[model samples]
Target: MSDCNKTDFTNPSTFILLGIPGLEAAHVWISIPFCTMYAIAVLGNFTILFIVKMELSLHGPMYYFLCMLAVTDLVLSTSTVPKTLSIFWFNSREIDFSACLTQMYFIHCFLVMESGIFVAMALDRYVAICHPLRHSTILTNSVVAKIGLAVVLRGIMLVLPYPFLARQWPYYRTYIIPHTYCEHIAVVKLACADTRVSSYYGLFMVFCVRGLDMIFIAVSYIQILRAIFSLPTKDARLKTLGTCSSHLCAILAFYIPVIFSSLTHRFGHNVPLHFHVLIANVYLLVPPMLHPIIYGVRTKQIRDRLLRLFTHKGM
Candidate 1:
């Protein structure tokens, strides 16, 4: 009981991660699925990268954006999953402070990058379908390169403050984090000092960066929908919408779990701790695993290439 009440005046050099507060007994069993998802996410994203790189026909803005998304998913998931699995499977819960901050930075950085990639993809589809005549001219290779660069810079600039701000706060409360990964809020809340500024900054980064990205995507899609509807024939509209199906699936796969997890963490006070941890894990793991599969299945070009590759291998 005394240990529970004790506080450390110095910032911890190492923080202990309690994988899931109430689910310790099930950690081993839980690790099976998490491990499986990580493996699949890695394999699937690499396959997407492979397909896009090898297919000359895919040398366009859309596939370039897909490659960006795949790479972001890889980094985002890799930032947390291995450590999480270690906590679950081997009971290796202590993470070095610097390592934790690095993990936090990579996870949020790639998350923002992924959102920007989705917006780029939406714009790609909008131009292709809405203004086919100018699609080539507008989304040229150089323009796509510029957009990618901007996305990378935006992510870096926005998330760079997280670790610095976290470092400044005095973590006298406890060195134990009740989650698998070093989330910004999870780490900051351990500080005994006032954390409202850090907390509000997190909210600001989310709403300002991701919120604006979402708004851009939404507007692009509205314009896309108008263009699709204006098509004279049902088949024409269907064909055009088909091109966006994979992107739409990817967007939902990315945003729903993320938004739910963020809201649950900040606002769902009645929610169980284990449930919150599970949702946080799901938001990171599920999207990466699902994204490549969604694109592979919905995209006819990629689907055909995958089928050919496997069939040739079988032969």
Candidate 2:
């Protein structure tokens, strides 16, 4: 109701984000874990990026997707970790309206880009497995570059409406985002004007992008399975499947929680905020944190290269 007043809303130039409730009582205790996760997320993704770039053997389409994913993970985590950590350490949760919108834009942009990358990775796998004879022709260097550009453009286009819709709300006073990050829906909730159109559009976009990505991934894997089944030798099948294992695991880890959170947010609003926050954070942070480890362990060459790099640096 306080946000409904035009004068009061316009007068307040900044708004505070009330980060995860109950943290105020145990800030010091929470800081240790939060800081540790933040460090791991950043360092882990950076290490993956470094390893991918340093190892010349990983210069193929597979590792290309991995590198792009690592970059996306870095950008994704960096978009929110700083503010989340600051809330715990400095107890400062206030954010300017403009800054809030900026953060929301970048966060959503990277997220959609990540989704696009996943789709592209699926296509890469499809080519490698289902149509090996033409894999090189289908997923060439120039094609990968074009795919990367398309992903960025798609992400920007999809998320552009969020900020535009947000700016049109002339009566948004309190900017107390319930969650730790500048999620689009969370920011839209602060709008004094009716957000039905924006919310519907956002939900539609979420489903379309994520849905299409998932469907394509599924179709790719199905074809891959068919192709593997037709192979005469067990060794060939195993080798082909082995190449896809890490990607399958990464895709499952990333999409499961995201789909779960999206469903809960849309249909399970009756669920407690604690449950929502837990699911949302896991969806955002856990996949990125786990992705590098998954790939490193599954790919022997990358693992060995990373070990040698760490050994040389005495880390």
Which model scores highest in TM-score? 1
Model 2 steric clash total: 0
Runs in model 2 lying further than 4 Å from the true structure? 1-12, 311-315
Worst 10 residues of 2 by lDDT: 3-12
Q: So what's the TM-score on candidate 2?
A: 0.93
lDDT per residue (tens digit) for residues 236-285 in model 1: 99999999999999999999998888888999999999999999999899
